[model samples]
Target chain A: MAEQAFVTGKIETPVGTVPQVATGVSWRDRWGAFRVRLGFGRMRYTVEPGLYGVGAPRQDSPVLVTANYKLSFDHLRTALAGHDAWILVLDTSGINVWCAAGKGTFGTAPLSVQVAASRLAQLVGHRRLVVPQLGAPGIAAHAVKRQCGFSVVFGPVQARHLPEFLGRGMQATPAMRRKTFSLSERAVLVPVELVIACKWALPLAVVLSGISGLFGPAAFWENVREHGGWTMAGLGSGIVAGTVLTPLLLPVLPGRAFSLKGAVAGLMAGLAFLAVLLSRPGGAGNDFAVWAWLLLIPAIASFFGMEFTGASTYTSLSGVRKEMRIAVPLQVAATLCGMLLLFCARRLP
Target chain B: MRRRQLYLRGVATLRLEQDGCMGCGMCLAVCPQEVFVMAHGKARISEQDACMECGACMMNCPAGVIWVQSGVGCAQAVFHAMLGRGSEACCAIEEKPGGGSCC
Candidate 1:
């Protein structure tokens, strides 16, 4: 097979000619990362699972393990810039280390198998492998040692901290071990959320707009132009409120439940939409329509917000289940009531 | 910076059978939330509420003392589970031919 573009050269090892990878991420790599962030070709962005050399590693070099997901591999390689290391890329089906580990694809079995497949025992002098800390969820350190004769030493949570952690003799500080959901980290997730939301929102908007045009007083096209436009705007606002605003202002948003926080953001977006509507010529004349939107926006936003709990860092399975039990019913009821009010408004005026 | 806390305090299902712990300290080394600490050669829960139920400690523990209803804390996954889809359905990418989907 042809070598990947990121492969700069080859290192002659006892097992075979191991591909030597670039330590610096190229513009192409950056663009690929950006594309995946937008949810395009994300699952397909994987490198071949094998052993790769970085910075002319020798038999005594540390063997760092990571997933075959190109992004994860890139992060690890880039962090090891000036250091000589052997990267044992495990087959993780294109998922990142953390998520892959959660799925058990990055567990003890894969680690042991990869170690044997790469002939790492012969390639490295030491009987140790530095696994990413997040992979601990799947990796049984004792089991890996027993199965492969190599003890597992988990590295820091983020690959960027590798240099410092390695400099400190592979000891991660408390801060390095802990994962934080900072603003920038949350912000990067917004694009994919928005894209996924739009996939359903656009179609739902069309359906709702069509239904609105069927009942309003004016001619079909005329009503479609007025009511339908407002319907699209309302749905758009709800999507933005849930997927964008809720995540951006997560910490400050009131209520502990993600659904509640999303509702607040949705209500704010609804009010902003109302403000824009009222400022227009012959402001939305129907009070029922106004009430409909007031209910619908928050409901829509809340549902989306609740979905975000999947993406959030701190939420626990038990806590999310508890929140969902109450939140789902409320969201459904509010949506039904909002639709009823909207129908009433359209029928009258 | 202060860590942001999640809702419903003391809600995590994470439990430790103290008698079974061998004090290997794997839980302390692997936990991302600092939920575990070594005390008297055995692992103890230092911050139970902080546990995100990632199952790192449980998976890494040699003594099999830790237990939690481990799964993604995602509402989407819950909804999928409610609809008869598997709990791992959250954030599933479109699968290519001969490939599997993932979060």
Candidate 2:
């Protein structure tokens, strides 16, 4: 409800009553955004594109432009806090401004169209539109100016520094322009990534657990308890290491490619798993079982890390492609080999 | 996250055509990697190593001297590319690693 309020507004623009912006966002909107980010109930998210008022703004307020992706919209308004401004949201089909800009949805056409659609010229006295720095790629400043008779000013990379940016005559300091991927930023993304990965990982885990049961000489339930649990545990650990821990420990983990970093974490996880088994009276199963994990766990972890290269700030498209070209085949082969060894371990006396 | 010292090199696909540079300083402003800097009033490639190939600089450059083989860095796109299946990944659902089709 509060989320909609931000998007749905009625304000007196020079163009006359237009859909204005909300004065504030509530805790409900923040929670909703968090839930959606976690891959929960995503369908309900989104707000209409148009001009919005942040606080109570007269015609002289600065008009900031952003995408209609609820998160981007929410973050922009949240950053404004006590300031009075006009937010002009372009319909990016629920994508964040940075991503949408790259996609061309947040490009010069949309900016120009939204300016016209929102009747922005009539609403604001100034001819300047402050756009997020990340959106610069999609916009041709000269083209926008030529088309709309308004100039584009690229603002700071992050929304939090908008106040300082606006206060300093719109001059962004060097630090404000830089984009950093912090732990919190990476951590917040884990839930959705993990959930997405699990769509495949869980089914594979069950299938492997069943395969592991075939090797055990014990009763069916006994096999399920031992081999199934162990197999599931192995897959679970790999998923956690690859998806969760890798991103958190990304900086500390060794390697330039995310795959290498993930493999390193997977190795650590596998070692810990081995340590637990070795602590038991008989140590961990036979060589097949032990070697099997060594081959599989890191493979899974490496695969996760490699997949994550897409999400990280550091990796390049060509770099990711290179990593996948080399690493993906190796990972698949290792996992297959590990599965074969597990088959051997199960069949052997 | 702290900036990594080295991402995968021998693969960045970034090229700067110095002849076309007019020192407009647009590239410097748009690059997140600090990949370019103005020297003698013309833009020069300072640290091509860290370039994530976001292409923001290239897109914003009025002189059009910058070139980067930009694409998404995520696995899903790679997954699609490798298999030649499943069009582009959903922008609404996926966090685009800039330079990919998701952008």
Top of the candidates by DockQ: 1
After superposing candidate 1 on the true structure, give the runs of residues whose Cα lies further than 4 Å from its correct spot: A1-3, B87-102
Could you tell me how far off, in angstroms, the CA of residue A134 lies in candidate 2 after the best superposition?
1.1
Please list all clashing residue pairs in model 1, or write none if there are none.
Answer: none
Flag regions of model 2 displaced more than 4 Å.
A1-3, A7-9, A23-25, A42-44, B1-5, B85-103
How big is the positional error of residue A139 in model 2, measured in Å on the Cα after superposition? 1.9
| lDDT (Cα, 0-100) at A342 in candidate 1 | 90
TM-score of chain B of 2: 0.75
Query: Best-fitting candidate, measured by lDDT?
Result: 1
Q: What value does the lDDT take at residue A274 in candidate 2?
A: 77
What are the per-residue Cα lDDT tens digits for candidate 2 across A1-349? 4445554556665677755555467788878877876766554466787777877788788989998778778888889988989888898877777667766888998899889887778777889999999887688776899889889888999999999999999998888877777889899878876876787788888777776666677776677787787788888888888999898998889878888899999999988887776787766568887898898899999998887776777677788777888888889998999888877777675
- Let me know the DockQ for model 2: 0.44
- Per-residue alpha-carbon lDDT of candidate 1 for residues A1-349, written as tens digits (9 for 90 to 100): 3558999999998999999999998999999999888777788888999999999899889999999889899999999999999999998878888877887888899999999999999988899999999999889999999999999999999999999998999898989988888889889889888887887788888888888777778888888998898889999899899999999999899988899999999999999999998898877678987898999999999999988887888788888889888998899999999999999988985
Fnat of the models, one by one?
Answer: 0.69, 0.55
- Model 1 chain A lowest lDDT segment of ten: A1-10
